[model samples]
Target: MALTFLFRFADDVVEASDGSLYFSVASTKFGLHDWFFDVLEANLPHGQLLKYDPALNETSIVLNGLCFANGVALSVDQDYL
Candidate 1:
C-alpha cells in the first residue's frame, strides 16, 4: 500500500518484531538538496520520529522537535527506539 504523511524527508526506516515501522523525518521544511541550509539556518527543531502500523493503517509521530532526525533503530532487546 502507498502511504503519505505531512513529512516529506523520511530517511531511515526500521521494522519492529511485531511489524510496526519506525522511521525518521530529516526535516519538515527542507529536503536533501537543502540539507546544508537546514543546518546553517539552525532553525527551530522541525524533524521528527514516526511510527506506522500496518494493521491500523495509521502513522503517528513518536517524537518531535529534533534538529534533523536522520537515523532510526530499535534497541537490541526491542525495548526502546
Candidate 2:
C-alpha cells in the first residue's frame, strides 16, 4: 500500500535502497504562492523531513524545524541522509 500525508506543500523526494521513502514538506503554513510570505514571516521553521517505510506500514518525521524542507538526498555511501 501507498502511504499518504497531509501538508501545505511538498518538495523533493528520494527513495532509499531499503525501500524507505524520504520526502520534504516545504512549509506547514503556506503554499507555493505564499513562499515569500513564509520567508518574510520567518515563522519558526515549519518544514520537515519525513520517512515512510512500506515494510512497517508507518511514516515518521526524521527531522523538523527546517526553514523550508526543500531537498532530500542520500549520502554517497547510502548510509545516511
Candidate 3:
C-alpha cells in the first residue's frame, strides 16, 4: 500500500555529509494541499526545519517558528547549516 503525510508541507529538501536529509515543513496545521492558505496567512510562523538520519532512523527538529521555511539547504563546504 502507499502512504502519505510523510511531512506536512515539506517545501524543500537537501542532503548532508552524514547521509542525512534536511527539509523544511512550511506549516504545522496545514498540508501541501493547503499550501496556498498557509502562504496567504503569512507574517505568522508555522514552519520548521528538520534533520533526518537514515542510518539511525531518526528525525529531529532543527528550527521552528519560521515564516514559510522553504529552500532548505546546507553550506557549500558542508561546514555550516
Candidate 4:
C-alpha cells in the first residue's frame, strides 16, 4: 500500500538505510506541444528532491530545480547518499 500522494510528478525515488526516502518532482503537464516548447517545459521543475521521515510522519523538500530530474541512484555506501 502507498502512503501520501502529495507528489506532483514523481519520476524517481530512492530509499536510504536510515528509512529516509528521496524523490524527484518533474512536470505535471503532458502533451507533445507542451513538451517541446515552454521554458517551464524544458525546466520541467526538476532538482526538487523530497525526503520522507517515517518517525515524524512528515515529508519535506530537500532540493529544487533539478531540470528534468527523471532518475535517481545511490552508491553502495550509505554515506554517499
Count of clashes, each model: 0, 0, 0, 3
Instruction: List where candidate 4 sits over 4 angstroms from the true fold.
Output: 1-5, 28-40, 43-47
Give the per-residue lDDT digits (tens) of candidate 1, residues 1-81. 654677668899999999999989988888878887667766677789999999998888899888888899899999989
The estimated TM-scores of all candidates read 0.87, 0.85, 0.79, 0.66
C-alpha lDDT of all candidate models, in order:
0.86, 0.85, 0.81, 0.63
What overall lDDT, based on C-alpha atoms, would model 3 receive against the true structure? Answer: 0.81
- Where does model 3 exceed 4 Å of error? 1-6
- The CA root-mean-square deviation of candidate 2, after full C-alpha superposition on the true structure, stands at 3.0
lDDT of 3 by residue, 1-81 (tens): 322335778878999888999988889868878887878888777898888889977788888789888787688999877
Q: What is the C-alpha RMSD of each candidate to the true structure, in Å?
A: 3.1, 3.0, 4.5, 5.0
lDDT of 4 by residue, 16-71 (tens): 88888887666434333453342456635434577888877788867666665566
lDDT of 4: 0.63
Q: Which candidate's TM-score is highest? A: 1
Residue pairs with colliding backbones in model 1 are none
Stretches of candidate 1 off by over 4 Å are: 1-4
Worst 10 residues of 4 by lDDT: 30-39
